[model samples]
Target chain A: MNAKTSSPIPPAEWIVAGMGLLVFTAVLGLMVWDAVAGDQSPPRITVEVDSITRSGDGHLLKFRARNDGGETAAEVVVEGELPASGGETETASATLDFLPAHSERKGGFFFKAQPERETVRLRASSFREP
Target chain B: MVRRGPKTLMSRRASATHKPAPRGTSRHFLRALARAFAGAIVFGLPLLMTMEMWWLGFHADRGRMALLFILSLPLLVGLSHYSGFEPTFGWVDDVVDTFVACAVGFVSSGVILLLFGLIEPGMAASEVIGKIGLQTLPASIGALLATGQFASPEEREADQKRFRKYQGELFLMMVGAIFLALSMAPTDEMMLIAYMMTPTHVLGLIFLSLVVMHAFVHAVESSGKAYVPSGTPFWSVFLRITIPGYVIALLISALILWAFERTDSCGPATLMGSVIVLGFPAAIGAGASRLII
Candidate 1:
């Protein structure tokens, strides 16, 4: 009969090694999947007017722009327009940088005119590729 | 009469004392896994609870995140060399231990995040992966440190090789500095403190780093548990141990800051500010490693 029946390295170590290999391969695969699946489409920016609330100085017109596409948008310009009772247009704008795909940025445009009495419009003006 | 060779005798002795039975092997693995998980919790729980880390995971650059993963390979190898969770004799064994620790880290991070309700089915895949990946680093280090800190003396002695040389001591300090600096690297407060500090404050921090490192070594020496015996005068020990340790801590601090992209787009002064700010913790970690390891 043989004096011993096993290898120098223990079976437990082999099991641990197998687990490690599984994790490494899985993480690598996920990274590859992310690289391939990301940035396939151009960024589509949409502006949504969330709320108009009264601030101490004026009415705060809070709006957010959502990027629905698969790429990042930089220097995103969003424009807000308040129609006046006197038939004139008042405008405010804000710029956001490096807004990633499937993400949103929120900002507020203060207006002296009461937004509840008039129409408040918010739109995506322009966005550049980051 | 049967003939018994030296190989047979050696194998018999090994099996009798060192080797476990087949059924015991599986049990050993389960216990090791449990220990690793516990280590992950003990060391990584605070970072897991941090909201800033969560935010950083989501907002951090994906490219840098990938780079950090790539850079981590060597650190794992080194950790496995010095303080692996299992008895490893060869390169392959060390590599295996490194991977096992990583797997433990990954699973622990995922489980904790899931329990916290931070991970949801509707979340973006990138976000989910990034958060888990970022947390895996600290958790993996914790797993590596667990065996060193908790293993039975017999089990530890099976693998413990005394790192008594100057190079080994320096390497240990580097590893400890990196580990400790990492705990604070992901926070927003690093940059905030850097921004808030004046030039005078930066000088004070540098002085503090040196003084603290020296005092730690001095205290250890006075306590008579000095790991590396100083055979020379005060100047020699100061130059060899304290000054070099502080320098390594500063370098590690700078490297860690750069890895976290904390120094990105900053001027030299600001970069130095961040490095010195983080160096405070790194230096303490460096000094304390001597006593622990």
Candidate 2:
């Protein structure tokens, strides 16, 4: 007993120091990990118009369904044109759940001139959302 | 008979007492001043230091621009010392010195750290580990505080009091980090919880850094006044504290800018504020403590 416990330093001090070092190393690793992993992706929308003719001729804008994000986009829509007359597109008329992240979902609508008699209103009623 | 070493009991008993208001004539009033004004001026400095940034950010919002410019006026009060780059006072100089020391420390330690990360198995593994370490500053600060890394006491009595008194500020810093990360994280996309650094963050970091470093440097410098042991160089101590912190700041800044550009209305303020508020002070505090000592 005398030989083994010769050192008079408090036993707790060593214990405290050891625990502190362990915690420090653990935390140092965590800081590095958090730096890489923390930021949650933000909501976004990217349009994919398969084809388009001319600005005057107008074109039907289509959306590839699927959020191109870590998480889903809350709501997304396309607005290709707005004629001077007629009713606009509404959510009831458009696609839903068409876009998922990392995949393409096809959604589309036609663009036609109002024929000069009445102007058609082409509002963004066609939407595919999160 | 047992040869009783120098009675450590006296020192232990002395430290046991937690008294009110720091003692004696060594400008303890200044400590009080720190406490009193900490809230008000701490409130004011971040708005000031980053005001130039704010002006650049929302030049469109004329009213907001005007408001920020006005709110941060008092922040420039300490400009003479900061701009002069002179260590006019003992403690004040320590603050500036720690900042410089940290920069030096960062460069040296970063090279070593980069090497550590590149060492085959450790590189991939450490990279994963490193990400975990970056969550919040408290965990690191808690470690540093626990390590007894702060500067040595000139008069042991006063130093102890100072440590006890400011422990709240440190704990607050810890709490602040959690709040900042939470608010900045995408809990709800509609968080308008003062996402800017608001000068509060900068001042808090500065004061906390100064406090911790002042204590640390004093401990190392004053204690070693008698003798400096082998293998412990001033530069290495400084670097050990600095490298991790400065690297964290730089990395956070880069990430903030990247995120800002990538996302809508995801400005640099939140990230900057979080770094300045959450990470900066504690890292600096811990760095100041360890390196100074």
Candidate 3:
């Protein structure tokens, strides 16, 4: 098998391969840890307005939905409510396909009335179990 | 690239076999690493583009993912023994090659997925790891097989000869089956199609899968006289290799489905249906592994 006479591997090759081994080990460790003792809470989604942009004839409320729990939330519905002075609540809603745990997804809601920073409220309305 | 068939195998036998490429230099090793990268992209791009695969990265069972990772190591080692990036002289060399290929797979997957916007800076470490880790196995196997793909036909023929034994052939079939099955198992269509099929459809598919698999392998085996004796009866080869190869494909299909959590909600009938459906592609892969890998 030429075991005795085989050439030594390049040092750089060894270093890269070692790094590879480290990568695999870290991934496997994280997965195992997650399976064993990682977070068990259901998906907790929170939405926040990122910016207000003026579109043609309307304003776009850009938001980021962040999932802080241990599970994935699918079909997450985020709503932005603008309470008008006439006891009417104008709601702009957007549905995110998924908000995975510890991850963030970007979405936007459009409203005809210019929303004030103080009265504009953003909330995750609902999410289904993924 | 030269297309190698039984003719090349036969022609190469009259001349002396070519020596395996030398290993150990940094430049040479780096070249092999580059080939590994190319291979990773070639084999892994389909799955990387699949949305279901991305979803499974975070939502699939962690234990099953871990199990698949653990199982891939031995599979990589065996693959390295046969056709690693650079020729290896010992088990240590093969192990080194295995790790190198894995690193190549991991890095390539990360880089490509990031470019696709599937992975980003703020993404959770678990999700990023899961996505890349799941892709590493197929890419690593591709990295290992890269050598054969790029080698001269004679070198590839020699490599094939190393694993020409019955057990070796079976192992190769399993690898091929797993490779093809992994690509298809993550899609919801596997279940959807299974759900759409009736008992008669399922039966027809099974019969068709067997016929296609046997026909392909038989053609390949017959073309290469070294693979089977010329006088061997059709039923003998059918029973000995084709049937067993299909069984391996089905088992691999089932394993991949279970690993991806596709079978979690399935009843026995549905599970069997999906396995058979996947078995079709896997069987094709197994039968044609000799040509591709």
Candidate 4:
């Protein structure tokens, strides 16, 4: 309480408090905006076979998936398949744990045969709403 | 050193109350800023690196996130009251320090998350705030605790003396519980462990939490007379401190789970199971605070 002693509210404390209040207010405003006017749609995934490259005795089928919707997609199952000569299929899959809205996840599957020559199909099997 | 509790409120009310010696002011702002930076890195880096935490920030319920922020206010106040980075002379000063710690935490989280590309401009407003806000809890606590941990020996000694009060002890336990609980809250493992446990295992865990809480507090108390006394009736210590510490740990675990939306789809039985599973580590952290913090 003395004049020479530290004040209960120091000048520097005010600066710190102001900075904190500014951030807190900005964050709160953003959150409020998201709550009131944000998008509430679910995640929509589109899977594509980007490229087929040759690997050792096999073909590496590169694939990519994009989440173009509002929410996140969890455990997105992307399946790549090559129909074989005997009506059989060689399938490889990759499961992405999470893919946020407007984001992309790249992954691939490998086939023993040349995917460029074989009937290769890449598709999004399933995804959960995260 | 004098130990007093009831006198604290009275002395605090009086305008003429004594203040601890002021820390030197030649580089006060710079020193505080540096401490806050150090605290943020020490406490917040792990959460920033967690992929699940990034996922949770976007998908988690926004209402609950706001509620968690609301709850953090009082917790910060309590932390400042007991072991803040700077010595506070009154409630108003404590409030100011709490804000400062919050600012440091928010800035630190924003910078680090941005550097990691966890937050992108393309993301929604909620996503950015949620990510930074979630990390702020522990970072702010670290900022508040920075003073005591990084202070000169004399100042550290002075702060240690303040921890003798009952409320101070409780606040320490809460900090420890929150720190440990939060470290694992964003992981799938908590729910995985809950699923693996039978009802009987949950009961066993509850018993284990109490036992450990009691044992650790007893050991800390008996080892030093400077600690809160343990010579009183055994039942009193067990009921007053140990039980309450375990309860605090359980509540902290539940709060963390709820904030992360781990309990959204869970039934009440499963929710209780999850709390108990996480409560085990939380209780241990609470008890171990006597030695660690």
Winning model by DockQ: 3
Which wins on lDDT, candidate 3 or candidate 4? 3
lDDT of 2 by residue, A61-93 (tens): 444444344333334554444443446532212
Q: Write the per-residue lDDT of candidate 1 for residues B16-131, one digit (tens) a residue.
A: 78754332256666667677788877778878998767755655656666667777888888777767766555677678778888888988999999999877653456667777
Overall lDDT per candidate, in order of appearance = 0.75, 0.33, 0.85, 0.78
User: Comparing 1 and 4 by lDDT, which wins?
Assistant: 4
How many clashes show up per model? 0, 43, 0, 0
Q: What local lDDT score does residue A60 receive in model 2, on the 0 to 100 scale?
A: 50
Candidate 4 CAPRI classification by DockQ: acceptable
For candidate 3, what is the lDDT?
0.85
Tens-place lDDT per residue, model 3, B169-283, is 8888887787788899999899999999999999999999889888877777776722565557889888988899999999999999899888887899999999999999999
TM-score of each: 0.73, 0.24, 0.93, 0.79
Reference-based lDDT, residue B184, model 4: 85
Give one digit per residue, the lDDT tens place, for model 2 in B98-137. 2222222222223433444421221223232222222112
User: What fraction of the reference structure's interface contacts does model 4 contain?
Assistant: 0.40
At residue B223, give the lDDT of candidate 4.
60
lDDT of 4 at B169: 79
